[model samples]
Target chain A: AQSVTQPDIHITVSEGASLELRCNYSYGATPYLFWYVQSPGQGLQLLLKYFSGDTLVQGIKGFEAEFKRSQSSFNLRKPSVHWSDAAEYFCAVGAESGAGSYQLTFGKGTKLSVIP
Target chain B: EPEVTQTPSHQVTQMGQEVILRCVPISNHLYFYWYRQILGQKVEFLVSFYNNEISEKSEIFDDQFSVERPDGSNFTLKIRSTKLEDSAMYFCASSEGINSPLHFGNGTRLTVT
Candidate 1:
């Protein structure tokens, strides 16, 4: 079974500081990786995804994630953090069975807080 | 851009009662999914529907849960007898393909009291 672990439960960063949210997964093979953001009272929004090729993936809202195959990790990063970027971030791993069945396993999520 | 929509932003049902959550996926989407998140917990995949039938489902989707595409535009999840554990925010999502990004609705907050 595939599982995701986000080490940090909550992170606080000052405005304009760089940010990185760590994510690690345990799976036998390389799997589809994704990062999603959820604002209060809103649905999950796709930040970025890593299906294949290009280890460094860019997404909306100036977010980027790098897929490290050897480490079984995909970490999301931003050069500068804004106050509006405060929200809970989730990292998910997509697994596929031999029969074309697929499922996404999500991590506990990291709550990002930006200080002005 | 089109988006997935779910009916009844919030629903409160008594334990042992039945509840139906409705969703309308994007018109051109080929895959539909239902996921639920308990308060402060990670979202869990309940089931996926494609071609008018269930393509995949997780263990959480027990015999008590059923899904149907009754009409052209409606996809529904029926819980035969709601339990307190069934209380969660149920999200409806749709994707064009296995690799495409899924668009999620605001979700129906099911509160079983």
Candidate 2:
């Protein structure tokens, strides 16, 4: 079974400051990774994903993540965060095989608070 | 910019009552999924459907939960008996293809009292 862990339950950053959200996964092989953001009372929005390619993947809103096999980690980062970027972020991992063949295992989510 | 849409943004139901949550996925999408997130918790997958059959489901999706694609544009999740624990935000998502990224609906907040 593939599981995802996000150690940070909450993150606070000032506007224009760099931010990083840590994520680690336990899987037998290379897995699919995804980052999702959700504002209060809204559905989750996909931020980025890593299937198989360059270790560093770029995503919307100037966010990116690096897949580190050695660390079993895929952390989301932003050179600078905006006030509008405040939201709850989730790290998810999916296995290649499962009854829900493409089912995603999500972390507890890190609530990001951006201060201006 | 077609996206998934869910109906009944909020529904308050009595315990032991049946509730149906509806979703209209993107026109070109093929696979459908349902997930739930309790207050202050991680999102959990409930089930996945394709070709009018259940492809996968989680343990949380027991005999009480059922999904249907009654029409080309509608996908529905029905809970037989609403338990207090079932009160959560339910999200519906769809993907264009097997490996395509999924688009999600705003979700139906089911509140059982």
Candidate 3:
């Protein structure tokens, strides 16, 4: 089965520091990757997605991710983190079975804590 | 922006009681899904519905769970007999088509005592 791995369980960084959360996935073919952010009391919000095309994709809230096919990795990154960016981040891989039903397989999220 | 909406933000039910969680997907979305997350656990896919029928379901979706699209705008998930292990935050999501990003609702917190 296709699966996702987010190696970092929790990451703490200074407010102005650069941030990178690593993700690796195992899939049979070209994978569809996504990054989602969840605040303490809010629903999961789509940060960005990569179905195909450019290796780097930009998303809302100053977020971007790079899909490295050879490494089977798609890591989320930000140039300068803000206190508001302290939230749980999830990496997911979109999969489609032969039946044409599609679902997202999510990794164990990485909780980010930003210190001012 | 259009979004999926779920009702009864929080529901408390007895172990053997039944509970129904409701959702109204984005107006034009054609694919619907239900996912659940136990506290401190990864979000899991439960089932996917399309064309008024279930297209796929995970092992977690067994005989006890059922889904319905009774009307044009309503989608529902019913647990016939809730169990303690059923306590989790259930999310409803929808997408325009295959390969589209899923838009999730705020989620319904189910607590079975």
For model 2, what is the C-alpha lDDT against the true structure? Answer: 0.92
lDDT of 1 by residue, A1-116 (tens): 99999999999999999999999999888788999999999988889999999999999999999999989999999999999999999999988732344678899999999999
Chain B structural similarity as TM-score, candidate 1 = 0.98
The number of the candidate with the highest TM-score is: 3
List model 1 lDDT by residue over B11-53, tens digit each.
9999999999999999988778899999989999999888888
- What is the DockQ (computed on Cα atoms) for candidate 1? 0.59
For residues B16-96, could you state the per-residue lDDT of candidate 3 as single tens digits?
999999999999998899999999999999999998899999999999999999999999999998999999999999888
Clashing pairs in 2: A99-B56
Question: B1-113, model 2: which lDDT tens digit per residue?
Answer: 88899999999999999999999999988889999999888899999988899988889999999999999999999999899999999999998654567778999999999
TM-score (chain A only) for the predictions, listed in order: 0.96, 0.95, 0.96
Q: Name the runs in model 1 displaced over 4 angstroms.
A: A97-101
- Which residue pairs collide in model 3, if any? none
List the lowest-lDDT window of 10 residues for candidate 2 chain B.
B95-104
TM-score: model 2 vs. ground truth: 0.97
Q: Measured with DockQ on alpha carbons, how good is candidate 2?
A: 0.60
Error of 2 at B35 (Å): 0.3
Positional deviation of residue B71's Cα in model 3 after best superposition, in angstroms:
0.8
